[model samples]
Structures are given as structure tokens and as C-alpha cells.
Target: MRLWLGLPVASALPRAHLCVFIPISERSRKDGALSLAALGTWAQEQLQRDAGAKVRFVSVGSTAGSPLEPYTLHVPGDEEVGYKRLPVRILKIWHYLGQEDDCDWVMKADSDTYVNLRGVSDRLSCFDPEEEHFFGVVHAIVPPRQLREMWPALYFGHGGSGYVVSRGLLPKVGRSALPCLEDMLEMTQGDAMEDVIFALCLQRRLDVQVESYGFLRPGGAWDAQLAEQEFVVNFHQARDELLDRRPKAPLQRWLHWDAQPPPLHACVMVAHPVENETDMMEVHRKLRADAAAQVLALAPTASEWAEPERMPLGLGRAQCVPSPMALARQAEVRLSAAGAPVKAFWTPKQLEQLSQCLVHSLGKKRCGWTDIREQRYGLSYWPPAQSSDACAEACCRSGADCSLFQYRADEGCWLGRWEESQAVASDKVWQGAVKVW
Candidate 1:
């Protein structure tokens, strides 16, 4: 991971690369002196101690610092509004690539962000860096009232959260898109936000595909339980205080394949003979109601058997046999040969484990509603319900597809699809009930 820091600065640089990047006016240099000293010290420590991949910290600004002259790259721009800074910095990186093009990805971030570099490298390995790709926790931005007419749809990654651009796409952006971008910046009188400008250039102008990932951001509310998982990558708006507070874990801790438990892939071999399609449907419904059973295909007749030649059990067409016992025996043999753990009889404990595994593998925990209410979107209406409990029961009985229900005191229940139910601010009379896994 050849990581380079394209930090924009106005006044003094921090000792650590992680220090906050707050551009200061020329008059405030005295106030920034101490922070600059701290930054120099931190830079020395990083140079001495960090034995992994070498990270090049290049500070970008209008003028080079007296002390940090070696690390600073002087780009022509006003220090106050560095609108052209990013594209220029990126172009400079591309120029550096002309000399040494070994870097797989380029990360553009503010100094206040705490980046798990190993986590980023691991995530990038999943995609082809040779292709035009962009990654970030994407945010849909509504333009300011004054700029709304000129810029209608402004979708960008929150810069505080940070974003990554592939090396292959950077050169193209610099060559083809930068001129248009600079014009936009001039038009906005430097008011266009840097992240938004980058987003517009990549998506609207150059047509680069931006993929969103769930990397944590500062002040963004996330499931506290899930945030503890290894998948979370960065923390935005981090302060210097974190250096002493957080533990020094191995960088490899952040690098792991995001492997979820495999889905419960098993076939329910019906041992009892079925008369018709209705009988088969009823049997399928009953088995599916158990939750543990993900019955992919069914053998409803004695003439139908799960073929061992199919090996993995459910993928191929079902085979016919003389008896129901033959079908069960065939299913057991085939599933066992395919390396799946086979049991002669499924105990309640085993079934429960299977159900739990299915839930974990799917990764979406069902949402529950108690006193909450939503407006205007209902899939279907049911008969008059006396209470919320009755409405909930109705939703449950409506099969697994039913996601929610809204019930009025004297009226019936409204069955709703999960996507349609958007919560409204006003609380009228209706009570809502949502299915929880």
C-alpha cells in the first residue's frame, strides 16, 4: 500500500499526519507555531518507528514553509479558498506516477481523519484498481437555496469520512475532467465544496462508477454493536487525544476477508406420499414455517427422489424412485457425499441452530415497531382488527413476506411492504406493528 498524503495547509503543519488541517491566515502564524512544532516531532517519530510500507506526507499549499520546505509542494492558489487545490494535487500525483507508477490506489483525505490504512488496502484488494472506480460512504447532497437552480442533484462523499480513487482513473480525470472542473470552481467563485466538485467531475463529467461502503464517519450514528465489527474502516473528525486513548493493535487485525456464515442450504425430503400440488404446497408451507428449513426443492411423491448424481442436493432436477424411504435415503447419501453435515434426524436444537445461522448469514436484523406510525403507503387492507396484537397476529399469519401493519382502534389493519413504510412526523390514532426476526 503506497499511501501519499495530499494535505492542504495555510499556516503551520502538525507534528503528526493525523493532526487537524485548519487553514490559517498569514497573521495567525504566531498562534500556529506550537502546533507546527508538535507536527515536526510527530513526523520524526513516524519516520523512525513506522517500519511497514513507507508513507510519503506531502503538504500542498501556495507557499512552502521555512521549516517544512522539504515536505511542502507549492501550488499556485489563494490560501483562503483552495478550490483548485485537489485537481492540481491529483495532477501532481499523476506526474509523480510518470516517474514511479507502483501505487495501486490514491487516498484523498483531510488531516483530522483517522484512517485504518490496512483496512483500506484490504478493501481495495477486492476490486480491480486497474479499472475506473471510486469508493466512499456516499452522501446525497441537496444544493444550497441560492445554488439549487444551477446545481440540481449534488451527490458527494462527506470529505470528513474520506474517499479513495483508483490510480487508473486519476490520469483520465486530470487529462479530461480537470479543465471543466476548474471552470466550475471559477463560476461558483470558489464556493463549490471540494468533495462535491470531485463527485460532479467523476460521476457527471467522466462517468466513473462510485461504489459506497459502510466505513464509519465522525458523528454519524451507526449501530453501536455492529460498529465494533472488523469491517468498519475509518473514524472522521478524530482529535490528537486519540493517540493516547486507543490501543496499538496489529495492522493485520483490520485486514480480513468479510466472510459471512453460509446460507442454510438444505432440502426437505418429504417421506410421506402426496396426492396433488395442493398437498405438496401445504407440506412446503409447514416445513418453511419452521424457519430453520430453507427447502430449495421438494420430493412430494414416492416416484420423486433427490438424485445423488446432483451431489449438492437442490441444484439439479429431482429424480424418481419407487418409494418414499428410497427418496430419503438417496437425499442423505447425496448431501453427505457433497461434504455437508448430515443427520439421521434433525433435533429441535439442530433446527434452532440452522435458523440462527440463516439469520446471521442474511445480515439484516428485522425492524420492530411499537407506538410508531407511518403515513399513506399500504400494500393491502385486512378485516377489522380490535387491537394492535390482533393486527400483529394478522401480519404474522400473512406469511414471511409481510413486513409491517398499521391498525386503527375501530378500523382494520393495513398490511404494508417494508420499502413503502416511511415514518411521518405527526402521530394520529393508528398503531404500527413490524415483523422482527
Candidate 2:
């Protein structure tokens, strides 16, 4: 039931405690809701529905929203640029760790990035609770062209997304976050991708082993025609139409901790009873604690886990999506990854009506969907790549676990003892090997 492979024999791991922090930078007034209050309301609406997944609405930047109870974030000015976002997200995770006692893991994601809860649960359900490791999107990040435009010294990758981490690295990351933040601003690229900088930070700094699963990849990789789904935390800029409102697949069944049932009986813990403000607060608090314990306990033991549900979609998942349609036709809209016009009319009344029946949404507007066997991130090893598996063979050959590094092909990735370099291959040839990963 547990997957902790390497250990010191005496090294001990407690239950995996986790806190999912959705770092959202809603343009204080982009939705034309007219005021920052409207932004908060819109964001909260999305955060509330997913209360079951045990996440918090961490509103950052200049948006003056309501009290983010049970959850908190840094409020920076709108004019802040180049790495400001990273510090805000870092500070939030740091604050949570300081307050909690049992937390063993933490996931920071984008608000728009859809989270596949069942997908995540299934992944989280694979632990043994006695190993040391960390997991997250090992973004297929390319180094910057110019030194100044490049990520800061401590940071290596670009904009991080919905990913997991262990408490082992928390103290180091938390302690170093600010210095890296200051360096980000100094670069003055004026770029605002916080995750990118964060990605680099985790890859280079944390000395622990990191695994990337493909079950976390959200929808864009989905092709109804190809039937190549397998994604969990769909990320990198997306839209509403890009979102599959359809009930892709269930990631879990009703979970019962009471039964010593299969340890893999992973359940999606939704924070319920968010009927009022106080209810929202309580639900948020309880969910956070529960997520912390669930993940911490499982991390050392579980082979893998991911937020299988579409990360309540936002710009995070959208920007990375290689959509067949134009950005204007995305399911949701906001500024582009470059902070340009990501707004569009897929939100038209007619589109809205179409959105209502997406199957994932039961009366909720622009609601996220479940993670099918397809549409996963770089966490789980099950769903073979619709695109890449260069590392899988190596991993299996060595009798080791595999992890996916970032690649550009529309395929999937593997984690745990994977091949290091990408071999040149054609699309058609690679497509045939999709299932191998």
C-alpha cells in the first residue's frame, strides 16, 4: 500500500499533512465587475464550490477582497512587477507552515488552474508514509535568453503551478523565498509569472528527490478525437471552452477512513457546508487541516498523487494549453500569460448556456471538471503519454520509480528513475509510443 522505496532504515516519516494554496492574482478590475469586491466574489464563488478538495482562496496583488478566513495571502500593489507574485505566494505558504503543527506537505496552484480532485486523491492514495520525497510539475522550462531577463540566481525554472512538496524542504524554501523574491524584482524583466520563478527554486534548491507525474496535466492535452485524455492539474493558460464540462471520469468513490480498506481507497475530501461566511471559514479551516494530514501521512508511503480535478481553471492552466481554437474562444478569460488581452466572448450568453451543460457543472457557472483516465499531470505513472515517455523505459529498466522532466510534445511524462535527455522523434512515431510512457 505504500511506495517509499529508498530509506535510511531508521529514517521515520509521519502522516503527510498538506495545505493547497491557490495563489490567484485576479486583476483587481479585469472582470469589469467594476470593483475589487467583484473579483473577490467571483474568486470566492469558485473557491467555495471546491471546498470539498480542501483548498483555500489566496488572493494576492492589489485586489481588495473580503477576509480570506481560514486562509490568508499577501496584498501587494498592482504596480509591483517581476517576481512580486513569487514572494506573495511564498509568504502565504510560510505563514501556514508556521501556524500548523501536523502539516507534512503543501501544494500551491493557480485559481484558474483546474484541479482534478479524484485524480489527486488517487495519486495521494499511493503513499506508504515512511519515505522522504517531494512532487510537483517539473515544468518543461527553458532557460531565459538574456541574463537580465532570466530567472533570479536562486530560481531556475519559470512560473510554478499546482504542485506538491514535503515538509523536509519547507524550512529551506520558506527561508530562502524572500531573497529570491528580491532578486526577481532586480531582474526587472517586468515578467509576472510567479510559478516560473517558483519552479526554478524547487528544482535547484531542495536537495530531496522530486517526482513529476503526468496525471496532473489538465485539459488542453485532451483530444476527444484521439481519446487521449490523462491529465490532473491542467495548467499553463486556459479558457472555458477548453475546459471539459463533461464528466470525464471519477477519480474516487466515497472514501471511508473507518474501514482499514485498501490503503489506496483515496477519497476527494471536499470542504462542505459552505452555506454562510462563517461556514466558509469553518469549512476552509477544516479542509486545510484535513488536507495537511491526508497528504503528509501519505507522502512518504504513496507512490504518487495529484489534484486530479481540473484546478478550478484560471490563467495558470490556460497559458500552457495548445488549443485548437483561438485565445478569444477560451472557456474563461483574463490577461494572457504576458499580461495581454486574454479576455474574450466565450462568455457570451449563448456560450454561457453551453457552459451550463458541460456536465462537470451541476448548475454552477464555468465550474471545473473531474479528471478522467486522461488529463493527468507529471505525478502518476499509470496513464501513458499521449506525447512523451522517454524516461519510462529507463526507469523500468533500472527497477526504479520514474519522474517526468518537462518536455514540449503533446504526450505525457514519467517520474521515478527516468531518462535524462529527450531523444529526437517524429510526431507520428511518438504518437504510436504514447501508451509506453
Candidate 3:
């Protein structure tokens, strides 16, 4: 489909679905295993669970490639993979991966970042591979007054937060389709940030936009509340800045509020800023536990957990097991007690009936309603809808002003003019009706 670095872009050989690359420094590795150690095992676990998945994790560095237990790729460059030389490291990654032509997508992440490989796959599902799409938490590029003439207010994805590059655009690197390493190093005087350089290359050279995925949180932008409900793909913790509100770069604005962690929500796929190797392992352990809890929640019957053999992690029989429906009710009660307005309770059968009737009345096959129960956000409130269909209709009728709507069988409908970057986990909330423009 494309060609670059004097090599064929697409080959007849089998290709992995995604190639996740993390640039590492000898200093970081000396500090500990780096996030890749746990991540490699995590990736392998995912592969073991799903045979069809072909995702590879490779840690790239500038030094001589010493054989790591799992995987490592050494690119020729200066040994220091620090801020100033980040562009070189990144360009090297692209060039190497591009020549391989063994993956549909190339994801460049920092060693400090933890990636949820499954979540990455899920997010990429909606996008097409043929198109040159860049996915990440996008930031607007605003230069100082002095440099306004030279630099416009453009946008780029944060490298620490990690970003994805489609295979289609990989071959373009170091060629006319994209800037060569020499040009990039010269243009930035070898001191430019890698993410900014990447954004510039995609926008000016390839005329492509960086599609922002709000779920990818970086710095103090991590929302502890939203992660409880939404499927957050990744989180970036660069240095001690995960909790710091200070902007990493003068060109980027610090938009999100600060939030703490510890009781990491089950909905978060990837988490960032785990600078400590022990913390990285702990994060993975906690995520595995949460995943197991999800499996327990989805169990068909409480009796299933009665057997000691089936019980996992020595979960005692004395543990009071609650049904999924019961748990949902408990969550609703908590929200209701905390100032959430009470609404009518509809049985499953009744909800299904309402859903069918609303579909019939609205004459739309797909209602587009998402069961975001235990989640709530936005400032606008509208009359309650009887069903998710009714909420979608209301949002659609509200015109361009409404970008999304949250509906609850009990609490009714809420319209949002702007797409919410964060939503708190609440009871009985169903978010849907994204206005297609």
C-alpha cells in the first residue's frame, strides 16, 4: 500500500495486528525492569487467552541490544534516549518498524507508561487501517507571543501518554511522504520534542489530523471518577507530573484537574506514571484482580461460587455473593443517598418492552444507547425519557447543540451540548446518542 526507506511497505508475509514500541533508556532500565517487563507478561497473558490476537511488545533503545528475557529492539543512535534526542529515537523506531512491515499499527509509548493492549485493540476497532489516522490524547500547540509568527497554534499528541500510528503511514517516514531524520533534526535543531515533531510531520507533510481519544489521560488529567464507569484505554504518568497540574511543555495547556489514585477503577485498561517497577507490578496485579471480579460479577448464579474448587484466590464461602442485578440496585441506592434524584424503577421485562415500543415509534433500528449505568456527568438536564430510544430521539431533535445524552430508565434523560471529557460513575445512567455531524 505504501513504500519508504527504500523498502516495500506491505509484504505477503503474515502480520501482527499491532506492534507496540516503547523507547527506553539505559538509565531507566538500570533503575528497574521498566514498565515493559510487566507489560510483556501482560501481553503474553492476553495472547494466551486469545489465540487470534497477534500483538507484539518490543522495547527499543539506543545502546547495544542485549537480549532481554522477553523482547527488545536496539536501534542505532546515541545511547541517551532523553528529551533532546527523543525525535531521533522516535524516527528510528518508525524506520525500523516500517521496514519490517509486520504489523497493521505501530504504537509508540514511553517506558513509564502502562498500556492496556486489549483496550488499544478495542479503540482501534472503529477506525480503518487503510486511512492515515493518529490516535491519542491530543493537545493544542500554542507558542509564545514571540514565536507566534514562526509557529501557529497547531495540535499534537503527548508522547508520554502514548500515541498510535497506522501502518498505512509507517512507510512514509523518512521519505517525501514524511520528513527525513536529517530534516527533522535540522528543523528542530536536534532539541525539539518528539511528539511536536510528529504532529508537524503528519499535519504539514501528510495532511492528516490527530484523532483525539478522550479516554487516554495524561499528567494530572487522570479522572478517578470517570475511570469508574468509562473504558479508559490508557493513562500516562510522566515523572511526578501524574498528580501535578503543571504543564509539561509551555506550548501545551494544562486542561484537566488533578486527581489521586490507589483504588484504581476496574474500567481503566491502561494506567500511567508508574515510575517504580514494584508499582508497575502492583498495578498489573490489581488490574488482574479487578478483571477476576468482573468475571465473578458476570457469573450466572451465586451457587457457582459455592464450590471451593471453583472459588478463586481463596475467596471464602462465607463471602456474601450478590447477584448482578442486586449489585446494580445497591449501586443505585448509594447514588440516590448521595443527592441523586430518585426515579421510577423498571423491571428488565418492562425495560425491554419500553425499548421495543420506543424503537417502533421512532422508526430507528439502532437506538445507539450505551448502558453506562453507574456513570453520570454534564451540566444540562432535560425531561426524563421513558426509554433509551426516547433519549436518543430527544438528543437528535435537540439539533446540533446536543453532542451526547445520558438516559436512565429511572432518572430520565440529560443532554450535553459538549461531549463530556469525564463522567462520574453513578447508578442507572445510560450514555448514548452521539450526534453524527
Candidate 4:
């Protein structure tokens, strides 16, 4: 069976760790309304207004663009734009930013996309920056014909919408993904899809957890109504469709303001395919205006406005499971704290008692528990727990169905029930126990 996991539960770092990366093409830069110059200028202005915000917008592309903007980075690659060279371009991008250590997360957004820092921050608040995670719109579709043999059922994150990589995994992309480059090119016969190859490298090589959020969508319009119902963070293909100039329909009447020219709402975090400078500005202006209006609405009086309380990270999602990496960090902290505070409490009598307890520790703890589960199973297949004790406690309180508990250093904890089995020698790696009373 295919094992699927939910989103992250622990929030170790703040949203300041997220870095926004956008890829722009020369064709889009020159002719398309969603040019690098337009998007970069707007993003730079937004960053300027919020001086304290550390969310950097780094745009990457070939060398043949106009003098690069402060937020834009030019990588050395052929200026060709298509699926054939996308993998190389993406590799170049990763290689360029491989040494990024300040931010714990990198969000790769399209150039035409208008990203809302607040929205992105909210969506990512619950995730741990130290852990390896890949988030985007996940599609379980077939790869190109040439790659069918290599990847039978390819599950990839759609890059057109946007995708995020945690700091623990992003750095390894450049250094680790190089070995598979030539093989990947040959497998696809030079027609490589960036998102597919990216997913493969992360899942197969780095063992990063692939997560999908329902709120993160591909093509949709943002308005007050849709924003309220769906917590949409990324709205792809935000450009207008067909403009009817035929007799009766006026510009305002003909345009679907809700979809095409997106109506400004505080809920929208990122809107893509804004194919023109004018639409980009319009969306930007509406966002700013709505933000100011919200501030005014929240004020007790016209002149006096209380600062809004910031929601703590990791509280956005309801039920969550802490990742293995997060559990390891927690274990380290617990170990350090356990020793630091009791340095002075070790008197002569206490030391003697401690030595005695350590000597008889194994027999005492092992008295009321059986290692039946360890003889038949391992904790590698179980979900992660904060500690072994926590895992056993969870099994105890998990009702009659939970008869066995297993724990390991790397895998955390496992709880299950199976037919009664003969007792076997206990193991250090997979410690399985069940309380008698």
C-alpha cells in the first residue's frame, strides 16, 4: 500500500527563513506583458516598504536580459526557453543558490506570479525549517514517453503553480543532483521536465517528504467570496482570457473581474500569469489598499489602532505529526536540558542512589513489559513519536486495540496489535514493550 503523510506539526523557525525565487525568460522579459522588469520593480518596491521583512525575491534567468535588477540574478546558460533545457536551467538556478544558509526555505515562483509574503508565511508557518520537505500541487501523472521506463508512475509537483523546498534539502539539490544529470537527460532523450526530475532527485536521492496542500491550487481566480471559502495561497494563470469588444458588452461588463482581473482580497497570497505590467500594478494597488483598509477596520478609534497579535506558527493546521527530524531535535534539547539543570543537585547520597538506579535500571523497567512485538515486527514501519516513553504511553492510552509498542532512535515509535507470540530476546535497536498492568 502507498503510505501518505500529512503536513508538518512543529514550527521551529519563523517565516523570515523563506526566500522567494522566480525564473524569468528573455522572451517573457521583452515581449510578454509579464516581463522581469515589471515584476522585479514591483517586488523591490514592496520589499522597500516593509524594511524589516527578510523575504528576498531572487529572480533568475539567462545572461541576455536588460541590465539586471537588484532582485534579479543572471545565470550563465543558453537563452533557449522550452521543456528540453528546463532541467539544465533549473540545475543552474540550484547551483547558483546552493550556498544559501540564511533562509531555511526557498519558494520557487513563476515570474508572472504575484506573491504575497504574508500568505506564503501563513501556509509555511507550521513546517520545520530544519527538516527536508517538498510542497506544491502534486500530480500523479505520466512522464514523457522516453522516461516511462525510468519512472512508471511519476508523481511531481507542478512548477507552474509554485513549489517550496526546505533549507535542509535545498542546499543538497546542487551538490547531490549533479550525478543524475546526464542519466536523466539520456532517459528523457533531452526532453526533460524540470518538476519531474526535481521530484525524483528529492524523493529518491535525498528522501525528502513530498507534501501537498489542498489550498495551494494551479489555475483559479481570486475574489472576496472564493478567498473566504478557500484558503488559496497560489492562484496560477491570473491573466485575462478573451476580451469581447463586440458591440454591446462594455469593458467592465465583459471582463470577469473575479477571475481575469483578480479582485483584491487579503486572503490571496500569490497570483500567477499576470501577463502585463498594467494588471500587475492593478493587483498590487488593490492589495495595498485592502491592507490599509483592514488596519483601519481593526482600530478601536479613528486615531488609535492597536497592533494586531501575531498568530504563533504551527497553529494553522489542526491535527499534525512531528517529523523524524523534528523529533531528533527535540530529543537533543531534552538531553541537554536534563543534564544542565541537575549539575548542582548531585549530592553524595544522590550520586550513590543514581549509581544503584543505573545498575538495576534495565531489570526494573523490563519487569512489567514483554518484547513480543519485537520478535515479530520493527518500528521502521510506524509513525514517529517524540520519545520511546511517549510512544509506550500513547499505546497505553490508545484503548484495547493497541497491545504492542515499538521504538527506535531513527524511526521514533510504532504501536500495533498482533497474535500472541512467544517471548524473544530484546533488541537495542527495535525496543518493543507492552505493559502488563
Candidate 5:
């Protein structure tokens, strides 16, 4: 059976290939030991048990303490004032770890962040350790003139989000970039972010290849909606309470690629006939061409798409209907027959009702469960309610495959294909709609 959409089944990497390092302080050792360190150990054990993937996790701290005695690697630095010396400490750890152990990739993470090692292994499988590759959630620095004197341009991964460096780039960075950074730190009196400094070393000095990945959760208030994401690799700034309650939230099922089977293409029936024959002809031509190209690129036959099991959650074959109302009705039929998730185009009137229901539910501090058939439904977005109702309607009308609508104050409206299983309590500003058929 297929695991996650688009991603193929990946083979496990050898235990010696991957290493994860977490930077902790002496003061926060207890909390770190109970939270991040415990989670990392659990993740490693789980992956080893489930997928036969071996991963090493280590804690890097400056001070010697009982809490860190088991797996801690004591580097030469002052633990109390380590923030200013973070870049130096990181370099020292890299060099020291390189000498002590043989690893293909070295990942640096914060004490509060939770990592999904299986996802990390899967992502690393795509690149070679010999290549000078840097992987992380990339962020560009925009200026209002604070440190223009030290560096001209700056781009770096948010360190709380974590980053990975290949074995090939380590020596180059140590040889060339570390000395320059040391001189710069001495001249500037050490007030730079470690992530920015590292990125400058990789991108500006060595000109290594940087690959951005979206596995890191954005920094914001906690949203339970994120638990539904199929490919989330890490969560930063997670609350201690949440982690205590749901420790397994960071690791989802691993996605594996399955062999191609017979294609089952859905027939599109244009319920609403267009006025101009030429316009209809052009539409048909474009659709046919696009479908043919997709089949040629990924499938063995024109009639076959990836099996429904392999498709992304809340996605299925497309169907054309006469109007938003007709589409909703058709969706009801599909939802009732197969009891599968279905998407429907919504009219402005229907969208307005959804928005009002969401607002009302939010105000009442209750889940926004709209009545669809005999059951209640809610919106399904990661950040939840990304846009306005008007924007959502426009998206539904513009695209041939939009099914759900959500609107939030200041954020505007968003269109999505999948429906959320349940409405978790969210910000009061968010609103959503589900098909009521």
C-alpha cells in the first residue's frame, strides 16, 4: 500500500550516515532533558523499530552536568554566556564531531524543536554527501540599516527551525569561512546571529548549493490544524504542555513510492454549456494537451493517474458541473455513495453562510461544525482560514478542482480541496465552510 502522496518508499540509511546535534544550556538542562532530548531519543528508537533506520542523537553543551552526562559532548566554551559564542561553539562541535565520528550529514537543532528523523532521512536520500549541499528553511534578511557595515547581503535559515550541512562542506567551511567569521566577530564584538553567520559562510564564501525545504513549521501561535499535514518534518517553539500531552505529534507516517498500476481516469462532464463554441473548443484542447502531458511524464497510459491511494489527501478525479449548486449536489452524491472526501464549488450565497457560521462559532468559543447532511463539518487548512470569503469564491470559480472555502479577518480567503476531520479550537478571526449536501 502507498504511504504518502508523491513520495516513494525510501530505503533506510545506514546508522553511521546521519547525526543530530542539539544545543542546550546548563540552566535549561532539566527541561531539555525531559522535552527535546527525550523526544529525540524516542524518535530514534521508534524509527529503528519501525523502519530499521538507525540515527544518532547527541546533546552539545558547554558545562559538565549530571543531566547531560549520558550523551553530552562537552565543548570548550562558557555555558552561561554561550549565546554570543554560538557560531564558535557550532564550528568547534562540527570539527570535533567530524574527527570523532563518520557521518554523511550533520544536523543542528535547538533544544525546543521536535524533529522527524524518518522525514530527514527521506529528504537526505535525494542528495549526495560528497556534494557541497546546504539544506534548511531559507529566510532572506531585509534591512532598515542595523548591521550594514559587517556584511553587505544576508540570507540564512532560522536556527530554531534547524539546518543540515553535508560532510563535504564541513572542511571547506572550517578552512576558509571559520577564520573570516572569527576575525569579523572579533572586530564587531560578537553580536551576530549564528544562523546568519553560517549562511554567509556557506553562500557568500564557499558558494555552496542551498536547497530550501518547507518541513519546518512557521513561527506563530500553536495550531492543532498542523497535525494533519502529511509532510511536516519539524515543529519549532512547541509548548511544553502540548509536547507533554502529545509527544508523537512531530512524527507522521513515512511516505513510500509504489509501483505504477493501471490508470483510472475520471471523465469530465461540463454540466454548464458555454455560449461560444470556439471558447469551448480551446478549453477542450488545453485540457486534453495537459492531461496527455501528465500521462507522458509520469504514467504508462493516458487513462491512468497515480492510484487514488497514492494521491494526496482530499484529492480525487475532477468533475465539471453546470453551477456551484449542481457541483454541491454532485459532491453530496459522491460523499454519500463512497463516504469519501469530496470537493464542491460554492456560490456566493453559500460562501456567505459559511463565513457567518465560522465567525459565530469562533465568537462562541465552540468548534465551527457546520451541518452537512446529518453530520457536522469544518474547514481544513494548516494555518487555518488564510483568506476572505470573496477570495475563496474566486479561487473556487477560477480553478477546476477547488472543494473547500475558508476566510479570516485580515488574512483573507483560501480555497482547499480537502475537508478537515474535526474543528480544533482556533483563533477567533478564522472562519470556514464545508459542502452541506
Candidate 6:
């Protein structure tokens, strides 16, 4: 009984869920109607056949009350061309939905066009042809060879490569939560259009398939009439006219799924391996907020942490890990008996990574890294455990401090500074680790 109430057929789609996300510029729609002339009906036809298909038509626009500061961000240059930002935003929304809802297939495309539905359906249904799931495109943009003669730069474009994506292939949100590829591009190189660069993001960040659709019309784009007869999903202003002539939702005439579904109770979807990406950013977000509070408490006497450094900082020389249960004797310390103690060296790169992780987890603060020598120590952020509170409280009572963050593997907690009667290294194997007296 996981009851979710939404549009009809929400539950039925997951077995073969295909999500159609069409994000159009609200003002960009032609002729004063949310529906494009002749396009809406045909787009609907592409989806009508599948009872599980969910077609989400979204219009993006800035509200009147929005302030000027947001103008640059809200109306990025890409909006003028109806290029890729809105699609990115729409995918993000769909991703958020997938976390809570039950759609497994995601189809993102333009508003004014028609897709070849039957051709797409045939390609889609053939999940095991060359590969089970992949990216299909309608067109490709490529520069030409002899184009150097006249226009010199207007050659690289291909047609009939459709855009298709399956739901099971979504990218994991990073635990470290990397920047939007566009932002990264701006910092690395001068900014470039996201449409051209989006492919790179998919390959580098998400590592999913990004091949062109075998049945797409490419750059020239398909018109309403020929598109209807040739493909299952035809693009642009042609759907309504096509549907109007025939007058029926495709669901009435489509194929019924023959595969019997497994029982719903505890049915499992083996999470697609991120391979390396971590999306447990929520864990780090909380860790950061907590660390910020703790840090503020650390040097409250100072107005802010960013005061220019009068001197370079160090974590101090080596420390030692004392014998275990030593605290019981007289504020004893416990060292693991197994192997050499771990060395907690503070490299600048590691420090910066830690700081970024903290900032990412915690939001920007008035303070920055300090120049003080590392009299104090820090630990990696691990996810919280049930015993975390007890261990943290015990350490605190015993005069210790700690922090927790979600690692790529799982939630981990790191214990920090501990008082010792005899100085010891926190980790012994690393050189120069000794406990402070």
C-alpha cells in the first residue's frame, strides 16, 4: 500500500515508464495559445498509445515580482534560442520526481516539433537489439569539410537523429556535488553554449550513452504532414491536425504488455551503479550546516574567520595514539592494537577539498581558512550511525570533538581532538604522528 495519487495511470508506467517532458518558453508559444498550432495534438498522439506514458508540458517564464538581481540568471542567453537550459531544468525536475515517483523512461524534446512515435516505439520496444538502453537523437550538428570555401563555418549538422533517453539510465547526484558543467566550463574556458557542451557533461559527469537517434530529422526539422505518416512521433504543430482528422487517443489502439509483473511487495530496482558519482549530497549539506555552527562557536571572539593571515599555518608536528582504555586509568587514551597508527597529515589540496566540502555542506560564511598552525585536528565527514550520538557524546564528555559527513561509500563519522595524559598519534602508521601533551 504505497498509495500515490496523481494523474491517471501513474502506477502503470513504471514497468515500461516513458516520461515525456516538454519545457517550452511560455511567452515563446505562437498565436496566444499555450497549445502550438497543429503541434500539440500530434505530440499527444505519440504518447497516447502507452497507458503508462506521462506527458508533462511545462512553460518557463519569470514572474513580474522577481527582482533585477535575478535577471541575468533567469533569462540566460540560451532562452532566446530555445536551446538547452530549459531542458536541463526540466530534466532536473524530472529527476526530482523520479526520486519520489515511479516513472522509468524520460523523453525530452521541443514544443513546436513532432517525433516519429511508431519508429520511436519500435526502437524503444527493441530494448535488446544492439544494447538494452541508449540515447537516440533526431539530428547531429557537425562542421563540414569543403565548407571552408564559402560560409567557412556553417557545415557541421546532421538530420534524422532523434533525442531519446530511458529512465533507468539517469545520473546520480554527486555527494561532493560538483558544479553545473556550464559553470565549470566558464571557469576553465570562456563560457560556451550549454547545448554544444551538454553532450560533454553527459559523457564526463554522468557517463551515460549519448548517441544520435537513428530516426531523427536533424537540423532541418520535420514538418507536421510527412512526419505523421512516417514516424510514430512526428514533431511540431502537426499533432492536433493529425489527431483531429482521425479523432482518437492512441491508447485505444496500442499493444498490451505481455510480460506479467512480479508481485509489488518488496519488488526491488537494483540501483544503477554510479560507478563513481555520489548523489548523497543531502548528507553533506547537513554536515556542513553543523560544522558551520561548530566553527562559528570555535572563534566567536573574532568577528569573522577571513581576516588576512599574519603567519602561515601548520597542523603542528606528529602526534601519537595512546594505548586503548588508557582514559579509564586517568583520562586514558585507546590506540588500536592491530597495525601502525594512521598519520593525519594536512596537505593544502586535502585542506582545500575539506574546506570546499564544508562550504558545500554548509553555505558560504563570512570566514575563510585561517593561518593558525594546526593545534586542532579535523576528520573526514562520514554519514551518521545510530551509535553516532552515543559515541560523540561520550567523546565530548571525555573531552573530545568530532564531525560527521557522508562518504562515497556510506555515512561516516570522524572523531576529532581528544585530551591525553600522554601524547599519542591519532593514526600511527603515518610518519611524525604524535599526541600533543
Name the best candidate (by TM-score). Answer: 3
Ten residues in sequence with the least summed lDDT for candidate 2: 257-266
Candidate 5 residue runs with Cα over 4 Å from true position: 1-15, 29-31, 34-41, 44-68, 76-80, 98-101, 145-153, 215-437
Task: Report RMSD (Å) for each prediction in the order shown.
Answer: 23.5, 18.2, 13.2, 16.7, 21.3, 25.5
Report the lDDT tens digits of candidate 5 across residue range 172-265: 7656544655764776555667787777667656776344432222333234323212222221222222123336554232321111111111
lDDT of candidate 2 over 1-437, digit per residue (tens):
32111111222444333446554445533212212231243234444343223445455443344454434444333122224445545543553443333335566654333343434433433332224445554333334446435432222221233556555566666665656656666764325466555655455555443343222212232232111122322211111112222245522222221111111112222211122233223323333343444554546454242242222322112121222111112323222222112322122432322222221222211211121122223232222223333333322322222332222354444332123324443333222122233
RMSD of 5: 21.3
Model 3, 162: alpha-carbon shift in Å?
1.1
Q: lDDT of each model, Cα atoms only?
A: 0.40, 0.35, 0.51, 0.49, 0.42, 0.30
TM-score, every prediction: 0.40, 0.39, 0.58, 0.53, 0.45, 0.35
For TM-score, candidate 5 versus 6, the one ahead is 5
Model 1: per-residue Cα lDDT at residue 189? 46
Q: Is candidate 3 or candidate 4 better by TM-score?
A: 3
Q: Write the per-residue lDDT of candidate 3 for residues 1-437, one digit (tens) a residue.
A: 65322224455545656667666665664323664454444455454234223433333433334334244455444346566867876776676666655666767776666665654554454355655667765555667767766766666767766788777777675353225567786776668888888777777777775754323333353343334222222334322332333475522324542233324433354565556666565555555565456547756466555443233321211111221222222223211111212322222332333333333333442334444444546534444356667666655644444567666666666666545536675444365555555
lDDT of 1 by residue, 137-248 (tens): 4555665667666766544555645566665675676565446546665776445566776677676667764544322222222323222222222321111111122345
Lowest summed lDDT window (length 10), candidate 6: 265-274
Rank candidates, lDDT, best first. Answer: 3, 4, 5, 1, 2, 6
Tell how far residue 340 is off in model 3, in angstroms: 38
Per-residue lDDT over 1-437 for candidate 4, one digit per residue giving the tens place of the 0 to 100 score: 21101112235533345576666665554333454434443455454234212323333443344434444455544345564667766766666566555456677766666666555554455455676767765554554667666655655666755678877776787676565566676777557778777877777777663555323222334333233221222233233322212345332322332333334454455565555676667666555555555655654364332321221111111111222222221222210121112111112332222223322322222324666444544222333345777566555544444567777777666665544434457555566786665
lDDT, residue 5, candidate 6:
17
Report RMSD for candidate 4: 16.7
- Among the numbered candidates, top lDDT falls to 3
User: What is the TM-score (0 to 1) of candidate 3?
Assistant: 0.58
By the lDDT metric, which is better: model 1 or model 5?
A: 5
